[model samples]
Target: MASNRPAPEAPYEPSRHPETFGYGDFRADEGPWEEWNPTEDSLQQVRGRHRVAKQRGGGLARSSTVLGVGVIAAVGAGGMASANTGKPPVSIAMPDLPSVDSLLGNGSQETPAGSGTALSALGVSSDDSAQGADDAGEALRNRIMAQAERQQGQAENKATAAADQRILAAAAQAEKVAATQAADAKEKAAAEVKKQAEAERLAKLAKQYTLPTSSYTITSTFGQAGAMWSSGYHTGLDFAAPTGTLIKAIHSGTITEAGWAGSYGYRTILTLNDGTELWFCHQSSISVKTGQKVATGEIIGRVGATGNVTGPHLHLEVHPGGQATGIDPMTWLRGKGLNP
Candidate 1:
């Protein structure tokens, strides 16, 4: 009870003794002393400086329990965010989207990167890339179709050009053939006309000539010596006259023969350009040889009765090409502008 008595107060000396609490031994005079103002960061630092909170258990087990509680809370918050977004649950959940490369495990061994990626390795902007890809695809398809159409058109044009060439060639050949045929026909017609004109001139000349002999009374005509002849008459004209009568050529032609023949006794033959022969037989005398030429009416032989003659007579004959058959001498003489 005696110690409880109040002592007397000392005099207030601020500069001499300044300590209020003994924690830092600081006094009011130590420099300008101030209390640590409690900002939120400062307060948290103060709380961190305090000791760990007391746990139900102790030591390492207590720390492990607190860590487990923190992990569970983080998982619950992420699940809530995913459900609210209405997106599918990711099979491989990653807390940090950019840090999802950790799923490949720590790269103690280098991991292979994807060969092809939707995004370029370089940070290029992907603006409008999908639209650009669609446009490129459409453009490629259109180009391919256009090329096919152009090729088909070109092939058609080539075929048409070839056909046209063939047609032109055929037309040219036909024209050439036609021209040749026309020219050949023209030449043939000209030749035919020329031949016809020549034939007309020859026919006119033949009309001017006359028959070498005339059909007249022939009691003894040419080719009448044998039984095959009519009446078995002599082969020439037999003009019964006394021997030594005048004989003359029937026409103005060369005399081919004047002879004394055994069968005919005396004979004279003449020749003309058209291969005609004239004869006078059974004459008195022959005035010319084999090749002697004589004119019409010129004396060549005379009438005589010689060699197998029945009586005194004169035999006159005319022949063509010296054949055995004789024509009428009187007609031949008149045809050459003379008379027998």
Candidate 2:
């Protein structure tokens, strides 16, 4: 049912589809073909030529379709030859990559899937409870140590402060003691000077007390005397004077006894600070009392011959340390730097 016609005398050359039509190369004899238009004869001739070339003849076309299919099948079937498949393939993915050896190592290497390192380093199969316990224990130990250290430091500070306070207190006390001792020493020195001066004064007055009462006769010395004495001899100096003469304390002292005695009659005994005793005997009347302090030249009683005395006179005795045996009153008084 397709076109059937005689073939052209020659094969068509390469040109546009329009140039291969009836308008193409009609004849150079027809001058100026670029200007020539196509007619029915040229059209029929081109169509008839294409008709013979496109016509399929016999089994050659069917054989060409079968050959094309055979060539495609032959190339794809070549992979089946020498199929020596070894080594089972493995699939690895996230969480555990089995393909790490095949995929990641350098220079064509295959490494073991299970790592030889610790589980923690490999981030696999580690003990979570033990790690947490260790962290908590370390924190607790640190807190305890810090608290103990703080307490120790506070104790040391308190001890240092206490030691400083003790040192200051001790120093102050020592200074106070030193000042008190110094004052005591100064007072003692002044007292010693006053005592020496007083001693000198009393010594000078002792001789005068033995002087004659109103310039009267002595009547008797200490060693030899008349039979009117109790000690077998005159034990004291006797001053013969008028009645009612003044009897004075020889020196400053406290009166230890002041009253009438059985034999000495009115008497006063004064005790000095150095324990020397002054005895005034045969007084007409005593004006001082026991425990009374008297000064030098102070009138303590009146002179009278009320006892074993020859006449009206002052009987005076000096007893150092209040002993019974008496020393020579004249010589002792003179040694005290007295005028007598």
Score residue 78 of candidate 1 by CA lDDT. 40
lDDT of 2 by residue, 1-340 (tens): 3443543444322232222222334422211111112234533655333422221243323434553464344423322111112111122211211142332222232223332222222221224334544556677789999999999999999999999999999999999999999999999999999989887786666644433234556666678755677777877777677878877666678999988787887788989888988787888888888999977678888878887666788776778899977666666655555433
Worst 10 residues of 2 by lDDT: 80-89
Clashing residue pairs, backbone N/CA/C < 3 A, model 2: none
lDDT of each: 0.54, 0.60
Provide the lDDT at 286 for model 2: 85
- For model 2, the stretches where C-alpha displacement exceeds 4 angstroms are 1-214
Q: What is the Cα-based lDDT of residue 340 in candidate 1?
A: 32
What's model 1's lDDT at 128?
A: 35
Error of 1 at 67 (Å): 99
